[model samples]
Target: MGTETETAPLELDDIQAGALRGRPNPYAGAFLFLRIDDPQDGRTLVRRLAKVVHPADDVTDPLTQTSFSAAFTHAGLCALGVPEESLASFAPEFVQGMAARAGLLGDVGPNAPERWESPLGSDDVHMVLVMLAPNRPQFEQTLELARVTIDDLDGITGVYRQDVFSPADGRNSFGFNDGISQPCVEGAGIPPTNPGERPVKPGEFILGYEDETGSVAPVPQPEVLGRNGSYLVIRKLYTDVAAWRRYLRENASGTDEETLLAAKIVGRWPSGAPLALSPDEDDPELGSDPSRNNVFLYGDDDKGLKCPVGSHARRMNPRDAQVVGEIRLHRLIRRAATFGPALPEGVLEDDGADRGLMFAAINAHLGRQFEFVQAQWIGDGKFVGAPDEVDPLAGAHEDHGTFTVPRRPIRRRLRDLPTFVVNRGGHYFFVPGLSALRWIADLAD
Candidate 1:
């Protein structure tokens, strides 16, 4: 019995653009999550949470959910207060009861196994209540605002919720244009994505309401592999601008950063044309163009020619576009972002500190979606031409030095080092809806 009301869809693109321009911090948030117990009964919990958050209107469509996001102020990353959290606001008995069930009350140790990822991440809270939307769904405004006020009360600051533009373009510290080349939604068969192997549909990742008690499943047989399961891949990426620059300047004899970065990191230039098309060059306008960005694939002949056999995009989603014989069934939407500040000027200032992306993705299944990409393409060099080259962009080959991946066979090892990217910190989470949120509040003291 889920229903939605109507409201003007809030523009995530514009909102992201504004944040990028102004450098928004991530302190103000009303993060709600399923109470540890709520999972036992999502339906009931959903109604209760919805009642509190959507008293004014039906929690209805995503637009309403998004608009309700538009409200109020939040603390910045450099805030100086620690506000009251659920545990502090809720009754001690209830808090104690749920904490016991969650096994948190039993473990007083600083480190707990139940936790995922390291450093600050999504697990710190459940559903994030951004105060950007308020019209369509306003019932939760009070609870959301209360949370922000609580954070303000404490001395904790927050970073901006990371959401970028259509293509997430922005300049890194070294100032070279970044966010240039990203993977298309694979089988979108639409703009932004290349015309090659299409990505699976978006609905596959979120809840398929119709699936609960529907006629036919969205993709025919839900019992196969993808069903409701979503693949969650976590990567702790580190950024090395100076090293990247050094590579650019050294390789500048033939290629420039503008050309090289896109090729190595994105497997294609900015134009969306695969390097398989132009191995030794770049297409800046092509890369930046929305209309013509994604238009190539890894066919047998065009394979090693336009794009390197081991290109990031190719490795991630081989464009032969083949699936379940020819089902072409998978796509990885990178719902991730960069962390840390621009690298400081001095070369030596690179203290190996923070400066990278916390990459995350949602998929239909783990094996078909993420693991297959990583194990088959990225980790295995045999797929391309070598045996050791993982994804230059996301590979975790520590042995690969400033310019070389060491201690690996030439056939298995890399010769000319590719510091496509560095890892920093990250984690994965299941993003539930408004209903799952109250469960979290109920868990609080």
Candidate 2:
């Protein structure tokens, strides 16, 4: 890790709030995609957006109720007439976009880009606007503010929009608590939620700062357009709630066993209590406590007795468990929210509802952070010493996969695991800083 002498205080006022801060629980948000038909119009839209988008420091304001963040696709940058030299400086994955690398992300068969929704991976998608608020009214108000930026602008067109919200219970479509275990960014002024968490270097998530390797990563030049910026990976995943529940029921013997099976697969109970801390049963109190819920490490449970090494949460963040690579290098700031209606509880049959999660992974290095986690961790199980296993909850299981649960006397192994999550569509975006937004808007022909 970088020493204090090499690290500097973060420029919170220049950075976008979404890149560092956690969203409010039970929040209302929307993601809006846009296409730039003309460079001048796109610049005008960015100029207006720069005014409403909240800075990282805005979270301290008591009156602040909404946050607006703006990001541009590689094609969007080109549409705005970014110079060739500057464009070449971006991460190669971002330049190629998410759809082009679908295979690496396990987006094959049903999740393939060819089957993705229109305008998502296409070149027509140039800009993305994310609005988040604590309630419906505030969310709508922020949406209106964003709409005005492109109102009557013939060159800028709205492509797609997804309304997302966190349920009162804070569980996702799969009935497990989401958005837990985020890496604390150094000098972000926000203390670690868990005492066991060591704050990661700011450069790991924001540009122009020293990363864990004690070196500053090369940002897209000129520095004004890249400093304090970060990469935003947006993916729309559809969770098959019915399928997940059915698998649990079929794998276990009874009601108590069924719930245990579900918890084993996720590495946590439905209430967010991790198995490492509450091994026997669901502890709602422990799960609700932010400080204690994510405080446990996997060093003691290396044998997969409590939380299986191949479980969804464990694979995502190994946390001192001696995984294939250093866990710190792959840490990501996730801001994911559930979209569509929650399936009525206890319904094992398919409801045929288009419900899932809107996942946004924030980081400075696209290749080593977001893409690495997706391709190597979630998509495969080689890192955890389970070469054939994958993340049971989010992995692309093709109806023939298996999951092993370590236990006393005899171990339990689940066979024929079906794919529970499907990739609907997504894109890689470059979230520029406040000054960079203006620089982009003020670009000359």
Candidate 3:
């Protein structure tokens, strides 16, 4: 670990609230993608956004108001007249943009950006506007405020927008508990929700700080532009809930067996109880307890007797489990929300409407953290001792995907698992620090 820096008061006023804070309520969330029609006029709109944008210091401010955050795509910065030399200082993957590396993240064939719903990979998308509130009305109120600011600017064009919020019981579209495991950033002063996990270096999630390697991460050119900033990867994933449930039903017998099969595949019960502790059945009590739910490690279950080694949870975060690389190097601060309505009670047929998750992962080093997880961990199961296996929940399976469940008598092998989740589209965004926002808005050229 890096030598600890003096714990000074973080510039909450200079950091965007979303990069450091979790959603206060489960009711409302939305995103807006915009294109820069004119550079100078867009900067004028940005200046307006800066004043109303939410800061990390929300506790003392007006409590009833909604929260908003803003970020830019690489092209957005270029459109705003940020110099080419300055832009070159950013990470290559980000500059190249998410669309260029879609195949590496496993968005190929049917799931490629060409088939994406809207302005995801196109040059048209330049900026992203994020809004969150306690309810729909408040959310819209906040959205309108942003809309009104850029209204008639003749500098920006609305490309696409999507609203996302948490479903009941913290379950995703797949009927399993989501967002249970998240990393804590050291010195961010945010209370650690998962008790057992140690806090990672702030540099892992924010700029101008030492990372787990005990070294400061490289900042983009012009110190103010990169300081306290972090890379944000936003992905729109569509889940085939009915198809997933149907597969389990066909493979396993009875309710009891079906539940177990689902648990094995995800490495957690529907209630979020990890198989590591409550191996046999779902324990809602343990699952709901914040202090206990995320406390277990894979030390005792290296062979995956309790949780399958290649299961979704284990692969995403192999806590204390033996792994090939430095675990801390690839950690991500995940802030995700489910979109689209849930399918009816027992219905296992296609609803046809779009439904999935608006996933956002924040980290300082985009390549080492978010991209590494997607390319090496989520897309491949070989590192965790499962060769040719992919994450059952998120992998873009082109070939016959398989998952092995260890049992006392014999191991159960799930073969030919169809792709359960598909990447509809996504992008690499630069969530600037508040100072950067000011610098951007004030640019002369």
**Which candidate leads the pack in TM-score?**
2
Candidate 3 — worst ten consecutive residues by lDDT sum? 1-10
* Model 2 lDDT at residue 304: 93
Question: What TM-score number comes out for model 2?
Answer: 0.97
The model with the greatest lDDT is 2
Clashing pairs in 3: 2-214
Lowest summed lDDT across 10 adjacent residues in model 2 is found at 1-10
Instruction: List candidate 2 stretches off by more than 4 Å.
Output: 1-6, 61-64
TM-score of 3: 0.95
Q: Comparing 2 and 3 by TM-score, which wins?
A: 2
**lDDT tens digits, residue span 208-257, model 3:** 78788878777887989987788989998898888888888899888899
Give the local distance difference test score of model 1. 0.38
Q: What would you estimate as the lDDT of candidate 3?
A: 0.84
Q: For model 1, how does the per-residue alpha-carbon lDDT over 1-445 read when each residue is reduced to its tens digit?
A: 1232212222222121111111122111132221122222322332343343322122233323432221111111001111344124222322222113222211112212234233323323222322323231342454555354434222222332432211124443334333323343312222354545443433333332221122212321222111222223444455676665565565545446445554655566544445665656766666555455556555654334445556566666665733222223344555344456666654533566556655555543334445455455655566565665666655545565222221223412224554545433222333223333333323322
The clash count for each model shown is: 58, 0, 1
For each candidate in turn, the TM-score is 0.54, 0.97, 0.95
Q: After superposition, which runs of candidate 1 have C-alpha atoms over 4 Å from their true positions?
A: 1-192, 195-204, 207-235, 250-258, 261-265, 270-280, 300-303, 321-330, 344-353, 401-422, 433-445
* C-alpha lDDT (0 to 100) for residue 373 of candidate 2: 95
The sequence of per-residue lDDT tens digits that candidate 2 reaches over residues 153-215 is 899989999999988787898888878898988899887877776899999999989888788
